[model samples]
Target: MIEILNPAKLAQARVTGALVADILQALKSRATVGTNLLDIDRWTQTMIADAGAESCYVDYAPSFGSGPFGHYVCTAVNDAVLHGLPYDYALADGDLLTLDLAVSQGGVAADSAISFVVGESPAPESLALIDATQRALRAGIAAAGPGARTGDLSYAIGSVLSEAGYPINTEFGGHGIGSTMHQDPHISNTGRPGRGYKLRPGLLLALEPWVMEDTDELVTDADGWTLRSATGCRTAHSEHTIAITEDGAEILTLPTQDR
Candidate 1:
């Protein structure tokens, strides 16, 4: 469903969004070479509890996923990209890591993701992939605002990634996010401009643009939720929850200092 948050709810949404952003920033800072994915998940649990927020993922059961995601955050490394269920794996130098998170506070939900290299052993190709996703995400957000169409955001995002010489994967992309984690108005990475759902004030969208290094294809891991690159090449994903406003689109998921 497409939910339009009232001013009261928007107030709460801003709070929730800040929490989501802060948590992600904290996790990114705490993560490093040799850090266990499970440790990250545990840290997330503590932070969420300390904030009195509820996790949108722990018990989330979507058709695309195998079952209830029994984790507080998604820890994707290297070849793994989306829905990366945290497991017993230690991050290594040069490993590209992606952390996706969503949480609900005061009945409002916000979602976001970030990708970064674990240590100094940064791979040039991995760095490029991460940069592309970040740029694509920025482009998508720039295209979002009142009176804009979902297609515009998609087109803007796709142009950046495609121009970067990376293949676009639409199997999983952005979506409406509000009271619930995922909602209506599916936003693909690439599409015809001037098409799809029209943007309006009070609408919230999680605009994510993810891509694989070598191919657009994806292969599920044995864990049932981690989506990895079909060619086992490194991948990256960037996302943020934004609110459509009368003046323009406001990025709700930016860090408190960034907002």
Candidate 2:
């Protein structure tokens, strides 16, 4: 369902978005060589509970997944991209890690993701992949505003990934997010401009641009939730929850900073 949040709801969204951002950043800082994936999940759980927020993931059973996710965060590493379920695995130096999170505060939900290298000696390719996804995410956000088409955002995102020589997989992409985690008007990583749903003020969209190094194909892990590149090539994903406004897009998921 497509829900346009009212000002009060939007206010709640901003709070939730900031919480998501803060949690992701904290997880990244704690992610180091030898850190267990389960540790990350636990950290997420603590933060969400402490903030008096609800997790959008745990107990989430979707058709594509095996069953209820039973986790608080998505910890994708190296070849893994989307829906990387936390497992009994330890991180390694130079491993490319992606953390995706969504939470609800005051009944409003916001989502965001980040890709970064864990530990020192990050491979050059890994660094490049992370950079590309970050740039694509910015481009997508820049293209969003009142009256803008969803296609415009997708096109802007795809332009960056394509130029970076990475292939985008459209099986899963961004979507509308509000009281619920995933909502209507799917936003692909690539598309034609001036097409698809028109943006409206107070609309919240999670625009994520993810790319695999070599191919656009992906395969599900035995966990039934983690999606990995078909070629086992490194991957990266970047995302942000944005609000369409009269002035432009406001990145609600940006971590709060002291002035």
Candidate 3:
């Protein structure tokens, strides 16, 4: 399903997107070295409720994941990258954590993710991984606009990651998002330019650029939801929901202060 939000829905989407971004930023601040993953999930649930928003993840039952995610947010640590189910483990110093969140407000939805180190002792490798994903995310966003092809965005994103020496994984990437969490026009982290769907006004896309430090392979954790690097290397993911408009792509998921 590829959903294009009308102006009114897009307005509501901005509100939802800001809420998602604020919550993620707050969670990032609260995630200390000893914070437990389950605690993060609980915090996320509370935040979503306080904002009068519906969690796009808690009851989500997608074919790729264990039914009913049962968590408000994804807490990925160290080697874990995608679909990270909140667990009982407490974050350790230097642990790289990724928080992915989505919510709906006023019948509109937005999704975003951020990766950072848990404590003050972040490793150089972890920092590099995080930086690479962030840069690639920016590149992807820069390549989006009305009339631009999805492949152009992918190529821009892939160039950054490839130059940074990280392996790209295509199994899970960005996609169109509005009204629902995930939608069609899958945006791979890497692809050939001038190919794939052409951008149009009103189209919403969640452009995420994620990569593993060493290999492109992934291994699912015992929880059946968390996806980790096959070589157990550190990973990072950065994402934001953008709306294509007459001028260009407007990032809806940036923190309120950032706008």
Candidate 4:
């Protein structure tokens, strides 16, 4: 469903967005070598409960997933990309970690993700992969505004990933988010411009651009949730929840310190 937030709803959305951003940032800071993936999930639950927020992922059972994903956050490391279910594994130095989170606060939901390297090691390829996704996300956001079409955002995002020599995958991408976690107006990572749903004021969209280093194909892990690169190459993902306004697109998931 395509949900247009009223003034009050938009206010609630802003609050939700802030909470999600803060939680992600906190998790990123806590992620280090030897940190267990399950620990990250537990930490997320604590923070969400403390904030009186609800997790969109917990109890979430979709057709593609195994069943009610009993987790608070998605912790994808290295080859893992989307729908990464937290497991019993400790992080290691130079591991590329992607944390995707969504939460509902004040009846509104916000979603966001971040890819970063864990520990002090910095692998050039890993950094480049993360940078590409971030750049694509920014380009997609920049192309969003009132009257803009979803294709415009996709085109902008695809250009960046293609130029960076990464293949595009449309199997899963961004979507409309509001009272619920996922909504209508599917936003693909690559598409033709001037097509698809047109943007309007008060519309909220989660634009995510993710890519695998050498392949666009994905394979589900044995867990039946985590999506990994078909070629086992490193991957990265970046996302943000944005609101279309009269002036332009307002990024609601930006860090509080950045506001």
Best by lDDT: 4
**1-259 in candidate 3: lDDT tens per residue?**
8887899999998999999999999999999988999999999999999998999998999998877999999999989999999988999999999999999999988999999998789899999999999999999999999899999999999999999998899999999998888899999999999999999999999999999999999999888899999998999999999999998999999999998
lDDT of each: 0.94, 0.94, 0.93, 0.95
Worst 10 residues of 4 by lDDT: 250-259
Expressed as tens digits, the lDDT of each residue in 82-195 for candidate 2 is 999999999989999999999988999999999999888889999999999999999999999988999999999999999999887888999999989999889999999999
Q: Model 4, stretches more than 4 Å misplaced?
A: none
User: Once model 1 is optimally superposed onto the true structure by TM-score, how far is the C-alpha of residue 163 displaced, in angstroms?
Assistant: 0.3
The list of candidate 3 runs beyond 4 A from truth reads none
Candidate 1 local Cα displacement, residue 178, angstroms = 0.6
Candidate 1 segments exceeding 4 Å error: none
lDDT of 1 by residue, 1-259 (tens): 8999999999999999999999999999989889999999999999999999999999998888898999999999999999999999999998899999999999999999999999889989988998999999999999999999999999999999999999988899999999999999999999989999999999999999999988999999887899999999999999999999998889899899897
Distance from true location, Cα of 46 in model 2, Å: 0.6
1 or 3, which is superior by lDDT? 1
What's the CA error at residue 218 for candidate 2, in Å? Answer: 0.4
lDDT for 146 (candidate 1): 90
User: Any idea what lDDT model 3 has?
Assistant: 0.93
TM-score of 1: 0.99
List, in order, the clash count of every candidate structure.
0, 0, 0, 0
